[model samples]
Target: MTNERRVLVHPDADALVAAVSARFLTKLTDLLDEHHEANVVLTGGTLGEAVQKAVATSPMRSAIDWTRVHFWWGDERFVPKDDPDRNEVQAREALLQHLPTAEDHIHPFPASDEIEDIDAAAEAYAQELRDHADPALRLPVPRFDITFLGVGPDGHIASLFPEHGVTRDGQDLVVSDEDSPKPPPRRLSLTLPVINSSQRIWMVLAGTEKASALGLALAGASPEEVPVAGAEGRLRTVFFIDGDAASHVPADLIASQY
Candidate 1:
């Protein structure tokens, strides 16, 4: 774990998406060159869709054997599988559906109807993560090659809202938020510890609304107060932000070269 952090600023959201999508494919290609399999965690939102759509359309999408790459989500809404609000649904429509990935390789958290409750859904996903972990290492969760995330205007990452108990919780690999600050309250999310376990954490931010949140995260605010601040990847932490979102970023914190 190098624990290196980088801030990449793009001129606009479109550019940010393009850059990220290309890097996503290129990095996956590099990882596949070194390993037989790789694990990638996805995110949900307009930004997520943009990135997925970019990757889906790019010719570079074929750079790696999609079947060998396992897809997981950092967080998911506690809704039915087909619900428009579900992260898995959006991801499938924008990208996964187009890829030749194996059915078992795409891991989506249990839907509301598929499970009795959010707690059960969290446990189910936790078990799923454990199932894919290296038995010899005895890990509770598999090592994520890359985990993509989005930060809320309020500085929340995934469903771990600011000041929420889930943000402060460290015991669980996966946690539920029944009272999220944002609408559509119910959600299941990987905890900060689990997120930090990833080899690379790519945080995509867009719009002026994210300016303050990015500042607080870069300022090192407490995770309970700004959960986005807690997302430090084992090897690298990257903030792929548009100029609007980068407005509040300190000059020194910005990485001159990626």
Candidate 2:
């Protein structure tokens, strides 16, 4: 069964980031109060980076025990660790550096130096997930309290593009490609099954470029034709979008805030 989705429209980009950051802190604090630890899968993109920066600067930044929160990336550019385009690099500079966390808690994708190739990196990451996942959960990945994601203009989620074979390749936890439609062609991403296994999924969308894609996904488009349409959390899925991105959504599909 699929989880229900909720769309929230903010006034602008900054507002969207602030709202998400605050909500993320609240969610983490609550989860820690209940379980004493939490795992979050992060995304890397314009909005993703922005949200991290917001979290670093938020007044509530010191509220949670960052060391107990395990961080994982949903996808990463296949480049050296220090490359500007690398998701792990950007995330560290934007947010992780500011938090009080143990080095072992940061689970970045294998960099070019650590693997023979992108495909090898994917397999290594899959192995890491399997090794760390709680045996009791009976799931391939860890218990992701919240997995944050960003949608591309073409309706792609993570590295899964429209009609891509990887989107349907359930056997693999992660997939790699050296010829992506987007730049920095080579990349690695978690498969749909791994992403959907999360307890909650938060999709952050911004700008007019994402408007049509959001419209199509929310309009019951097929997951193969619009990969973002298949991204759903097991317990709940929430879309935090700016006004520009929410513009194309049908009136009946959006909440009153719009």
Candidate 3:
């Protein structure tokens, strides 16, 4: 793990989405070139959905074989599969449905109706990851080429909220949350350890509400106090933020274009 961190600030939310979408396409293309297939973990939020929409509308959308690209979500609301609030549902409506990806390649967490117990659903997803992992990859989770995340206003990543017991929990690759701080308390999420295993991580931020959290995490705040501080890619960690979100970050830490 190189553990390199880069902070990129865009002019605004729209430019941020465009830049991220372009990079997403290029990253997938590069990974597919080196391997038979590529794996990417998706996030859910306003910026996340915007990025997906950008991808769907990008001219380079067809550059890679969508069938060989496996999609997984970092976390999902424990709602019915068809619920508009479900991350999987939002992703499909935003982009996945337009792609040629096979049903088998889209790994969405089980919904409430699919499994009676949230813990059971989380375990099942972990098993699914183990089954898909190639022995040569030697990872608890699949060797993700890129993992996407959205930092919450409170500095949480995925469903691992700051100071939550789950943030320090290392036992499960996927954890179940029945009491999330946000509404729709139920959720299933890949733990910080599991997310950090990815080769590359992209944390996308858009609005000013996230600026304080982003600033704190990038400045060496304790992960236990700010869960977003805990997640870093094995090779490369990137913060793709719009100016509003990057406003609170130190001028020196920002890569360029203030």
Candidate 4:
């Protein structure tokens, strides 16, 4: 991982989305150039959806082969697949519906109805990763080329909320979080260990309310207190902040060399 935190500040949310979209496309193109496929972990939120929309509408959208790109979500609401609140549903409407990607490439968490047992559903997703990865791999998890994440006002990422047991649990790549501050109460989230396994991770923030949380995360707060602070990718980790969300970060802090 790099020593410096890569923070990109934009004039507004629209500009932020454009910058993030370009970065996302560059990362995807790099992954495809090095490997035959690209695996991306998506998130659910306004900023996240904006990035997806950017990708869908970008002029370079056609440069990559959508068919070979694999999509996964960082977390999901434990709702029926067709529920309007489901992240998958929102993502499809925002971007996937526009992409030429194959159905098999889109892997969403199991719907509550699909698997009666939430724990079993999480385990099933873990097994799916194992099946796709080589046995000799130490991590035993798929190396995501890019993981797009959104931070909650409480400084949570994915479904890993502050002081939640799932935030510290190290075994499962996917786990059911039962005490999320935000509801539906129950959710499936990628553990911090799994999130750190990605080659690149990007945390996107847009609203003014997120400014305080962004400052705390940048200050290196503990994940137990602010879960977003724990994100660390092997190759790179970036924070894409709009002016509104970066207002609380001190000018000197941002000017410091790492």
- Please give, for residues 200-245, the per-residue lDDT of candidate 3 as tens digits: 9999987899999998898888888888888889888999998889
Model 3: residues >4 Å from true position, as ranges? 136-138
lDDT for each residue of candidate 4 in 50-78, tens digit (9 for 90 to 100): 88889899998988888889999898888
Residue 151, candidate 1: Cα error in Å is 0.7
- Give TM-scores for every candidate, taking all chains together and pairing residue i with residue i: 0.96, 0.95, 0.96, 0.93
Alpha-carbon deviation at 155 in model 1, angstroms: 0.5
Residue-wise lDDT of candidate 2 within 1-258, one digit each (tens)?
A: 557688998999999999999999998999999986799999998889999999999889899889899999999889888899998988999999999889889999999877868888999999989977866554677899999999988899988888666464456899998888888888899998888888899999999999998999898888888888888888888889989998888776666542
Residue 21 Cα positional deviation in candidate 4, in Å, after optimal superposition = 1.1
Give the poorly placed runs of model 1, Cα more than 4 Å off: 135-139, 167-169
Which stretches of model 2 miss by more than 4 angstroms?
136-138, 256-258
Error of 1 at 226 (Å): 0.7
lDDT leaderboard ranking? 1, 3, 2, 4
Candidate closer to the true structure by lDDT (higher is better), 1 or 4: 1
Best-matching candidate per lDDT: 1
By TM-score, the better pick of 1 and 2 is 1
Report clash pairs, candidate 3.
none
